[model samples]
Target: GENVGLHLPTLSVQEGDNSIINCAYSNSASDYFIWYKQESGKGPQFIIDIRSNMDKRQGQRVTVLLNKTVKHLSLQIAATQPGDSAVYFCAENIMEGGSNYKLTFGKGTLLTVNP
Candidate 1:
Protein backbone atom coordinates (compact mmCIF):
# COMPACT_ATOMS: atom_id res chain seq x y z
CA GLY A 1 0.00 0.00 0.00
CA GLU A 2 2.96 2.32 0.41
CA ASN A 3 4.46 1.62 -2.99
CA VAL A 4 4.61 4.83 -4.96
CA GLY A 5 4.31 3.97 -8.62
CA LEU A 6 6.56 6.00 -10.88
CA HIS A 7 4.93 8.24 -13.38
CA LEU A 8 7.79 7.45 -15.72
CA PRO A 9 9.78 4.26 -16.00
CA THR A 10 13.03 5.93 -17.02
CA LEU A 11 14.62 9.32 -16.62
CA SER A 12 16.90 10.81 -19.29
CA VAL A 13 19.30 13.52 -18.23
CA GLN A 14 22.21 15.40 -19.69
CA GLU A 15 25.71 14.87 -18.42
CA GLY A 16 26.70 16.87 -15.33
CA ASP A 17 23.14 17.37 -14.15
CA ASN A 18 21.61 16.24 -10.90
CA SER A 19 18.99 13.51 -10.78
CA ILE A 20 16.48 12.52 -8.17
CA ILE A 21 14.91 9.09 -7.88
CA ASN A 22 12.07 8.27 -5.53
CA CYS A 23 10.74 5.19 -3.73
CA ALA A 24 7.98 4.27 -1.31
CA TYR A 25 7.97 1.55 1.28
CA SER A 26 5.07 -0.39 2.69
CA ASN A 27 6.10 -0.87 6.28
CA SER A 28 6.69 1.94 8.72
CA ALA A 29 8.33 -0.33 11.24
CA SER A 30 11.23 -1.06 8.92
CA ASP A 31 14.44 -0.32 10.77
CA TYR A 32 17.08 -0.11 8.06
CA PHE A 33 17.01 1.22 4.52
CA ILE A 34 19.52 0.90 1.73
CA TRP A 35 19.89 2.33 -1.72
CA TYR A 36 21.67 0.27 -4.33
CA LYS A 37 22.81 0.86 -7.86
CA GLN A 38 22.93 -1.96 -10.38
CA GLU A 39 24.66 -1.62 -13.67
CA SER A 40 23.81 -3.69 -16.69
CA GLY A 41 24.46 -7.33 -15.89
CA LYS A 42 26.03 -6.54 -12.58
CA GLY A 43 25.01 -7.11 -9.00
CA PRO A 44 23.59 -4.29 -6.96
CA GLN A 45 26.26 -2.27 -5.21
CA PHE A 46 25.54 -0.60 -1.91
CA ILE A 47 25.45 3.12 -2.37
CA ILE A 48 24.13 4.38 0.94
CA ASP A 49 22.12 3.43 3.99
CA ILE A 50 19.99 5.22 6.56
CA ARG A 51 18.72 4.06 9.86
CA SER A 52 15.40 4.75 11.52
CA ASN A 53 17.11 7.02 14.00
CA MET A 54 18.31 9.27 11.19
CA ASP A 55 16.33 11.01 8.52
CA LYS A 56 19.11 11.59 6.03
CA ARG A 57 22.48 10.27 4.95
CA GLN A 58 25.04 11.17 2.33
CA GLY A 59 27.69 9.49 0.26
CA GLN A 60 30.05 10.49 -2.48
CA ARG A 61 27.96 12.19 -5.13
CA VAL A 62 24.76 10.95 -3.58
CA THR A 63 22.35 11.78 -0.80
CA VAL A 64 19.48 9.79 0.65
CA LEU A 65 16.58 11.34 2.47
CA LEU A 66 13.84 9.58 4.36
CA ASN A 67 10.36 10.77 5.32
CA LYS A 68 8.93 8.42 7.86
CA THR A 69 5.67 10.25 8.13
CA VAL A 70 4.76 9.33 4.58
CA LYS A 71 6.97 6.26 4.28
CA HIS A 72 8.88 7.82 1.39
CA LEU A 73 12.53 7.84 0.45
CA SER A 74 14.57 9.47 -2.23
CA LEU A 75 18.03 9.28 -3.73
CA GLN A 76 19.74 12.35 -5.11
CA ILE A 77 22.61 12.00 -7.55
CA ALA A 78 24.81 14.92 -8.32
CA ALA A 79 26.52 15.36 -11.66
CA THR A 80 24.81 12.78 -13.77
CA GLN A 81 27.20 11.01 -16.12
CA PRO A 82 27.21 8.27 -18.69
CA GLY A 83 28.74 5.96 -16.14
CA ASP A 84 25.95 6.81 -13.76
CA SER A 85 23.35 5.27 -15.98
CA ALA A 86 21.88 2.29 -14.21
CA VAL A 87 18.91 0.87 -12.36
CA TYR A 88 18.54 1.91 -8.75
CA PHE A 89 16.59 0.10 -6.07
CA CYS A 90 15.58 1.06 -2.55
CA ALA A 91 15.31 -1.70 0.03
CA GLU A 92 13.96 -1.83 3.52
CA ASN A 93 14.90 -4.37 6.15
CA ILE A 94 12.10 -5.90 8.13
CA MET A 95 11.68 -8.74 10.55
CA GLU A 96 9.92 -11.65 8.97
CA GLY A 97 8.91 -15.07 10.17
CA GLY A 98 10.91 -15.47 13.41
CA SER A 99 14.31 -13.86 13.76
CA ASN A 100 15.03 -13.64 10.06
CA TYR A 101 15.78 -10.32 8.44
CA LYS A 102 14.27 -9.66 5.06
CA LEU A 103 14.69 -6.87 2.56
CA THR A 104 11.79 -5.71 0.49
CA PHE A 105 12.65 -3.91 -2.72
CA GLY A 106 10.95 -1.36 -4.88
CA LYS A 107 10.48 -1.94 -8.58
CA GLY A 108 13.43 0.38 -9.37
CA THR A 109 14.16 3.56 -11.24
CA LEU A 110 16.15 3.55 -14.43
CA LEU A 111 18.46 6.47 -15.01
CA THR A 112 19.83 7.20 -18.47
CA VAL A 113 22.54 9.74 -18.92
CA ASN A 114 22.89 11.43 -22.28
CA PRO A 115 26.39 12.44 -23.11
Candidate 2:
Protein backbone atom coordinates (compact mmCIF):
# COMPACT_ATOMS: atom_id res chain seq x y z
CA GLY A 1 0.00 0.00 0.00
CA GLU A 2 1.16 3.49 -0.78
CA ASN A 3 1.53 6.00 1.99
CA VAL A 4 -0.82 8.93 1.63
CA GLY A 5 0.16 10.53 4.97
CA LEU A 6 3.67 9.97 6.26
CA HIS A 7 6.05 12.81 6.97
CA LEU A 8 6.86 14.81 10.05
CA PRO A 9 8.09 18.36 9.99
CA THR A 10 8.74 19.61 13.51
CA LEU A 11 7.38 22.95 14.72
CA SER A 12 8.40 24.12 18.16
CA VAL A 13 6.32 26.78 19.90
CA GLN A 14 5.90 28.04 23.41
CA GLU A 15 2.70 27.80 25.31
CA GLY A 16 0.30 30.68 24.66
CA ASP A 17 1.96 31.40 21.35
CA ASN A 18 0.46 31.13 17.91
CA SER A 19 1.31 28.18 15.64
CA ILE A 20 0.85 28.02 11.91
CA ILE A 21 0.80 24.77 9.91
CA ASN A 22 1.12 24.82 6.13
CA CYS A 23 0.01 22.26 3.54
CA ALA A 24 0.13 22.25 -0.25
CA TYR A 25 -2.56 20.34 -2.07
CA SER A 26 -1.69 18.64 -5.36
CA ASN A 27 -5.15 18.38 -6.91
CA SER A 28 -6.77 21.53 -8.19
CA ALA A 29 -10.11 19.79 -8.61
CA SER A 30 -10.51 19.26 -4.88
CA ASP A 31 -13.55 21.07 -3.54
CA TYR A 32 -13.67 20.34 0.19
CA PHE A 33 -10.84 20.72 2.70
CA ILE A 34 -10.38 19.59 6.29
CA TRP A 35 -7.72 19.86 9.00
CA TYR A 36 -7.14 17.00 11.37
CA LYS A 37 -5.27 16.66 14.66
CA GLN A 38 -3.79 13.32 15.63
CA GLU A 39 -2.38 12.76 19.08
CA SER A 40 -0.16 9.81 19.85
CA GLY A 41 -2.03 6.52 20.00
CA LYS A 42 -5.13 8.27 18.67
CA GLY A 43 -6.73 8.75 15.31
CA PRO A 44 -6.96 11.99 13.42
CA GLN A 45 -9.74 14.27 14.69
CA PHE A 46 -11.52 16.84 12.58
CA ILE A 47 -10.51 20.34 13.59
CA ILE A 48 -11.99 22.60 10.92
CA ASP A 49 -12.87 22.78 7.24
CA ILE A 50 -13.45 25.19 4.37
CA ARG A 51 -15.13 24.74 1.03
CA SER A 52 -13.60 25.66 -2.30
CA ASN A 53 -16.11 28.47 -2.66
CA MET A 54 -14.87 30.05 0.56
CA ASP A 55 -11.51 31.63 1.22
CA LYS A 56 -11.42 31.10 4.97
CA ARG A 57 -13.22 29.53 7.90
CA GLN A 58 -12.76 29.68 11.66
CA GLY A 59 -13.58 27.41 14.57
CA GLN A 60 -12.79 28.02 18.19
CA ARG A 61 -9.07 28.82 18.34
CA VAL A 62 -8.34 27.49 14.88
CA THR A 63 -8.58 29.03 11.42
CA VAL A 64 -8.40 27.39 8.00
CA LEU A 65 -7.48 29.26 4.85
CA LEU A 66 -7.64 28.06 1.28
CA ASN A 67 -6.02 29.50 -1.83
CA LYS A 68 -7.55 27.87 -4.84
CA THR A 69 -5.41 29.76 -7.30
CA VAL A 70 -2.20 28.32 -5.87
CA LYS A 71 -3.72 25.16 -4.48
CA HIS A 72 -2.51 25.95 -0.98
CA LEU A 73 -3.96 25.42 2.47
CA SER A 74 -2.96 26.48 5.96
CA LEU A 75 -4.05 26.03 9.57
CA GLN A 76 -3.54 28.61 12.27
CA ILE A 77 -3.74 27.76 15.94
CA ALA A 78 -4.14 30.52 18.46
CA ALA A 79 -2.51 30.20 21.89
CA THR A 80 -0.73 26.97 21.14
CA GLN A 81 -0.53 24.70 24.16
CA PRO A 82 1.00 21.41 25.21
CA GLY A 83 -2.31 19.82 24.54
CA ASP A 84 -2.08 21.09 21.01
CA SER A 85 1.06 19.02 20.50
CA ALA A 86 0.18 16.49 17.88
CA VAL A 87 0.48 15.54 14.24
CA TYR A 88 -1.64 17.93 12.22
CA PHE A 89 -2.75 17.24 8.68
CA CYS A 90 -4.96 18.57 5.90
CA ALA A 91 -7.21 16.41 3.73
CA GLU A 92 -8.75 17.38 0.42
CA ASN A 93 -11.78 15.87 -1.25
CA ILE A 94 -11.41 15.24 -4.99
CA MET A 95 -14.43 14.11 -6.90
CA GLU A 96 -13.65 11.69 -9.70
CA GLY A 97 -17.16 11.33 -11.08
CA GLY A 98 -20.80 11.75 -10.12
CA SER A 99 -21.31 10.79 -6.47
CA ASN A 100 -17.85 9.29 -6.27
CA TYR A 101 -15.02 11.18 -4.66
CA LYS A 102 -11.54 10.50 -3.24
CA LEU A 103 -9.87 12.07 -0.26
CA THR A 104 -6.21 13.02 -0.38
CA PHE A 105 -4.21 13.93 2.69
CA GLY A 106 -1.10 15.96 3.15
CA LYS A 107 2.03 14.84 4.89
CA GLY A 108 1.54 15.09 8.65
CA THR A 109 3.54 17.62 10.61
CA LEU A 110 4.53 17.28 14.26
CA LEU A 111 3.68 20.28 16.40
CA THR A 112 5.59 20.50 19.68
CA VAL A 113 4.53 22.98 22.33
CA ASN A 114 6.89 23.73 25.20
CA PRO A 115 6.23 25.47 28.46
Candidate 3:
Protein backbone atom coordinates (compact mmCIF):
# COMPACT_ATOMS: atom_id res chain seq x y z
CA GLY A 1 0.00 0.00 0.00
CA GLU A 2 1.09 3.57 -0.66
CA ASN A 3 1.58 5.95 2.21
CA VAL A 4 -0.22 9.23 2.59
CA GLY A 5 2.76 11.44 3.39
CA LEU A 6 5.62 9.27 2.14
CA HIS A 7 6.12 7.99 -1.36
CA LEU A 8 5.99 4.27 -1.78
CA PRO A 9 8.25 3.52 -4.69
CA THR A 10 7.41 -0.17 -4.85
CA LEU A 11 4.93 -2.79 -3.71
CA SER A 12 5.53 -6.49 -4.26
CA VAL A 13 2.66 -8.92 -4.60
CA GLN A 14 2.49 -12.59 -5.32
CA GLU A 15 0.73 -13.93 -8.38
CA GLY A 16 -2.88 -15.05 -7.96
CA ASP A 17 -3.28 -12.85 -4.91
CA ASN A 18 -5.08 -9.61 -4.37
CA SER A 19 -3.30 -6.27 -4.39
CA ILE A 20 -4.37 -3.20 -2.49
CA ILE A 21 -2.99 0.26 -3.16
CA ASN A 22 -3.73 3.28 -1.04
CA CYS A 23 -3.56 7.04 -1.53
CA ALA A 24 -4.50 10.21 0.34
CA TYR A 25 -5.55 13.54 -1.02
CA SER A 26 -4.95 16.95 0.47
CA ASN A 27 -8.06 18.68 -0.75
CA SER A 28 -11.37 17.91 0.87
CA ALA A 29 -13.06 19.88 -1.87
CA SER A 30 -12.07 17.29 -4.44
CA ASP A 31 -15.23 15.74 -5.73
CA TYR A 32 -13.78 13.16 -8.10
CA PHE A 33 -10.98 10.68 -7.81
CA ILE A 34 -9.34 8.26 -10.24
CA TRP A 35 -6.87 5.44 -10.17
CA TYR A 36 -4.35 4.99 -12.94
CA LYS A 37 -1.89 2.30 -13.90
CA GLN A 38 1.30 3.12 -15.75
CA GLU A 39 3.79 0.71 -17.19
CA SER A 40 7.48 1.45 -17.52
CA GLY A 41 7.41 4.24 -20.07
CA LYS A 42 3.74 4.35 -20.89
CA GLY A 43 1.26 7.01 -19.93
CA PRO A 44 -1.11 6.63 -17.04
CA GLN A 45 -4.10 4.49 -17.91
CA PHE A 46 -7.41 5.06 -16.20
CA ILE A 47 -8.66 2.18 -14.12
CA ILE A 48 -11.44 3.34 -11.86
CA ASP A 49 -13.04 6.41 -10.33
CA ILE A 50 -15.38 7.40 -7.54
CA ARG A 51 -17.45 10.43 -6.84
CA SER A 52 -17.67 12.10 -3.47
CA ASN A 53 -21.29 11.03 -3.24
CA MET A 54 -20.31 7.37 -3.42
CA ASP A 55 -18.27 5.44 -0.93
CA LYS A 56 -17.31 2.56 -3.19
CA ARG A 57 -17.34 1.47 -6.81
CA GLN A 58 -16.51 -1.80 -8.48
CA GLY A 59 -15.11 -2.69 -11.88
CA GLN A 60 -14.48 -6.00 -13.66
CA ARG A 61 -11.55 -7.03 -11.50
CA VAL A 62 -10.96 -3.93 -9.47
CA THR A 63 -12.55 -1.88 -6.73
CA VAL A 64 -12.25 1.74 -5.66
CA LEU A 65 -13.08 2.86 -2.19
CA LEU A 66 -13.42 6.41 -0.98
CA ASN A 67 -13.44 7.66 2.57
CA LYS A 68 -14.41 11.28 2.63
CA THR A 69 -14.00 11.48 6.35
CA VAL A 70 -10.33 10.68 6.10
CA LYS A 71 -9.80 11.98 2.60
CA HIS A 72 -8.47 8.61 1.57
CA LEU A 73 -8.83 6.44 -1.53
CA SER A 74 -7.90 2.90 -2.20
CA LEU A 75 -7.73 0.53 -5.16
CA GLN A 76 -8.09 -3.22 -4.85
CA ILE A 77 -7.02 -5.47 -7.69
CA ALA A 78 -8.21 -9.05 -7.77
CA ALA A 79 -6.00 -11.94 -8.84
CA THR A 80 -2.70 -10.20 -9.10
CA GLN A 81 -0.78 -11.09 -12.25
CA PRO A 82 2.44 -10.24 -14.02
CA GLY A 83 0.57 -8.02 -16.43
CA ASP A 84 -0.82 -6.07 -13.51
CA SER A 85 2.63 -5.02 -12.47
CA ALA A 86 3.04 -1.31 -12.89
CA VAL A 87 3.12 2.05 -11.19
CA TYR A 88 -0.23 3.12 -9.80
CA PHE A 89 -1.34 6.67 -9.16
CA CYS A 90 -4.30 8.48 -7.68
CA ALA A 91 -5.61 11.70 -9.16
CA GLU A 92 -8.12 14.13 -7.75
CA ASN A 93 -10.23 16.71 -9.53
CA ILE A 94 -12.48 19.44 -8.23
CA MET A 95 -14.83 21.58 -10.24
CA GLU A 96 -14.63 25.10 -8.99
CA GLY A 97 -17.07 27.91 -9.78
CA GLY A 98 -18.77 26.00 -12.58
CA SER A 99 -16.14 24.36 -14.82
CA ASN A 100 -12.65 25.17 -13.75
CA TYR A 101 -10.63 22.68 -11.76
CA LYS A 102 -7.22 21.13 -11.55
CA LEU A 103 -6.23 17.52 -11.75
CA THR A 104 -3.63 16.76 -9.14
CA PHE A 105 -1.73 13.50 -8.77
CA GLY A 106 -0.26 11.94 -5.70
CA LYS A 107 3.02 10.13 -5.41
CA GLY A 108 2.84 6.87 -7.35
CA THR A 109 3.06 3.39 -5.96
CA LEU A 110 5.03 0.87 -7.96
CA LEU A 111 3.34 -2.53 -8.00
CA THR A 112 5.53 -5.52 -8.72
CA VAL A 113 3.87 -8.87 -9.28
CA ASN A 114 6.15 -11.71 -8.34
CA PRO A 115 5.63 -14.99 -10.06
Candidate 4:
Protein backbone atom coordinates (compact mmCIF):
# COMPACT_ATOMS: atom_id res chain seq x y z
CA GLY A 1 0.00 0.00 0.00
CA GLU A 2 1.62 3.17 -1.24
CA ASN A 3 -1.33 5.37 -0.29
CA VAL A 4 -0.47 8.48 1.71
CA GLY A 5 -2.31 8.73 4.99
CA LEU A 6 -1.41 11.84 6.93
CA HIS A 7 -0.24 11.40 10.48
CA LEU A 8 -0.76 15.09 11.07
CA PRO A 9 -4.10 16.12 9.69
CA THR A 10 -3.27 19.82 9.55
CA LEU A 11 -0.32 22.13 9.14
CA SER A 12 -0.38 25.84 9.99
CA VAL A 13 1.95 28.29 8.36
CA GLN A 14 2.34 32.00 8.02
CA GLU A 15 1.99 33.92 4.81
CA GLY A 16 5.19 34.43 2.80
CA ASP A 17 6.73 31.20 4.07
CA ASN A 18 7.42 28.05 2.15
CA SER A 19 5.79 24.63 2.40
CA ILE A 20 6.99 21.14 1.73
CA ILE A 21 4.65 18.18 1.24
CA ASN A 22 5.81 14.60 1.14
CA CYS A 23 4.33 11.43 -0.31
CA ALA A 24 5.17 7.75 -0.70
CA TYR A 25 4.23 5.48 -3.57
CA SER A 26 3.53 1.76 -3.35
CA ASN A 27 4.12 0.66 -6.87
CA SER A 28 7.60 0.95 -8.23
CA ALA A 29 6.45 0.51 -11.79
CA SER A 30 4.59 3.81 -11.92
CA ASP A 31 6.04 6.17 -14.49
CA TYR A 32 4.05 9.41 -14.39
CA PHE A 33 3.72 11.74 -11.41
CA ILE A 34 1.42 14.66 -10.64
CA TRP A 35 0.85 17.05 -7.78
CA TYR A 36 -2.52 18.71 -7.32
CA LYS A 37 -3.87 21.48 -5.13
CA GLN A 38 -7.43 21.67 -3.88
CA GLU A 39 -9.22 24.54 -2.22
CA SER A 40 -11.95 24.20 0.36
CA GLY A 41 -14.63 21.91 -1.00
CA LYS A 42 -13.23 22.20 -4.51
CA GLY A 43 -11.80 19.80 -7.02
CA PRO A 44 -8.06 19.31 -7.25
CA GLN A 45 -6.28 21.65 -9.65
CA PHE A 46 -3.29 20.49 -11.58
CA ILE A 47 -0.16 22.14 -10.32
CA ILE A 48 2.67 20.35 -12.10
CA ASP A 49 3.60 17.03 -13.62
CA ILE A 50 6.78 15.03 -14.09
CA ARG A 51 7.62 11.95 -16.04
CA SER A 52 9.88 9.08 -14.97
CA ASN A 53 12.39 10.05 -17.62
CA MET A 54 13.41 13.00 -15.48
CA ASP A 55 14.20 13.54 -11.79
CA LYS A 56 12.90 17.01 -11.15
CA ARG A 57 10.54 19.58 -12.67
CA GLN A 58 9.73 23.14 -11.76
CA GLY A 59 6.75 25.42 -12.27
CA GLN A 60 5.87 28.96 -11.32
CA ARG A 61 6.61 29.19 -7.59
CA VAL A 62 6.41 25.43 -7.31
CA THR A 63 8.84 22.57 -7.68
CA VAL A 64 8.38 18.82 -7.87
CA LEU A 65 11.25 16.51 -7.04
CA LEU A 66 11.20 12.78 -7.61
CA ASN A 67 13.56 10.18 -6.22
CA LYS A 68 13.29 6.87 -7.99
CA THR A 69 15.88 5.30 -5.74
CA VAL A 70 13.54 5.50 -2.76
CA LYS A 71 10.12 5.69 -4.39
CA HIS A 72 9.51 9.03 -2.74
CA LEU A 73 8.07 12.31 -4.07
CA SER A 74 7.81 15.80 -2.72
CA LEU A 75 6.27 19.18 -3.55
CA GLN A 76 7.88 22.44 -2.60
CA ILE A 77 5.81 25.61 -2.56
CA ALA A 78 7.32 29.02 -2.20
CA ALA A 79 5.56 31.85 -0.39
CA THR A 80 2.76 30.57 1.74
CA GLN A 81 -0.47 32.59 1.95
CA PRO A 82 -4.00 32.40 3.28
CA GLY A 83 -5.11 31.56 -0.23
CA ASP A 84 -2.47 28.87 -0.32
CA SER A 85 -4.27 26.87 2.36
CA ALA A 86 -5.51 23.70 0.81
CA VAL A 87 -5.04 19.96 0.50
CA TYR A 88 -2.28 18.56 -1.65
CA PHE A 89 -2.16 15.12 -3.15
CA CYS A 90 0.45 13.19 -5.08
CA ALA A 91 -0.77 10.94 -7.82
CA GLU A 92 0.88 8.36 -10.01
CA ASN A 93 -0.34 6.70 -13.16
CA ILE A 94 0.67 3.13 -13.94
CA MET A 95 0.72 1.87 -17.48
CA GLU A 96 -0.23 -1.75 -17.50
CA GLY A 97 -0.29 -4.16 -20.35
CA GLY A 98 -3.09 -2.26 -22.08
CA SER A 99 -3.26 1.31 -23.26
CA ASN A 100 -5.20 2.39 -20.19
CA TYR A 101 -3.55 4.35 -17.42
CA LYS A 102 -4.64 3.76 -13.85
CA LEU A 103 -4.05 6.52 -11.34
CA THR A 104 -3.55 5.90 -7.65
CA PHE A 105 -3.82 8.87 -5.33
CA GLY A 106 -2.28 9.51 -1.95
CA LYS A 107 -4.56 10.53 0.90
CA GLY A 108 -3.53 14.22 1.12
CA THR A 109 -1.60 16.85 3.04
CA LEU A 110 -3.72 19.63 4.51
CA LEU A 111 -2.00 22.99 4.54
CA THR A 112 -3.45 25.87 6.57
CA VAL A 113 -2.37 29.41 5.92
CA ASN A 114 -2.16 31.93 8.76
CA PRO A 115 -2.51 35.54 7.86
In terms of TM-score, the best-performing candidate is: 2
Clashing pairs in 3: none
User: Candidate 2: global Cα-lDDT?
Assistant: 0.89
lDDT of 3 by residue, 3-72 (tens): 3324567789999999999998998999999999888767779999999999999998999999999999
TM-score, candidate number 4: 0.88
- Worst lDDT window (10 residues) for model 3? 1-10
Query: Candidate 1, which segments miss by more than 4 Å at Cα?
Result: 1-8
Locate the minimum summed-lDDT window of 10 residues in model 2.
1-10
Predicted structure 2, TM vs. truth: 0.91
* C-alpha positional error of residue 88 in candidate 4 after TM-score superposition, expressed in Å: 0.5
lDDT of 2 at 25: 96
lDDT of 4 by residue, 1-115 (tens): 1222246366778889998889898788899999988876677899999998899999998999999989999999899778888888899999777787899988888888888
User: Which prediction has more favorable lDDT, 1 or 2?
Assistant: 2
* Local accuracy of candidate 1 as per-residue lDDT tens digits, 6-39: 4437888999999999999999889899998888
Superposed model 2: Cα runs more than 4 Å off:
1-7
Clashes of 4: 1
TM-score, one value per model: 0.89, 0.91, 0.89, 0.88
Q: lDDT of candidate 1 vs native?
A: 0.88
User: Which 10-residue window in model 1 sums to the lowest lDDT?
Assistant: 1-10
Of 2 and 4, the candidate ahead on lDDT is 2
Q: Model 4: how far is 16 from its true place, Å?
A: 1.0
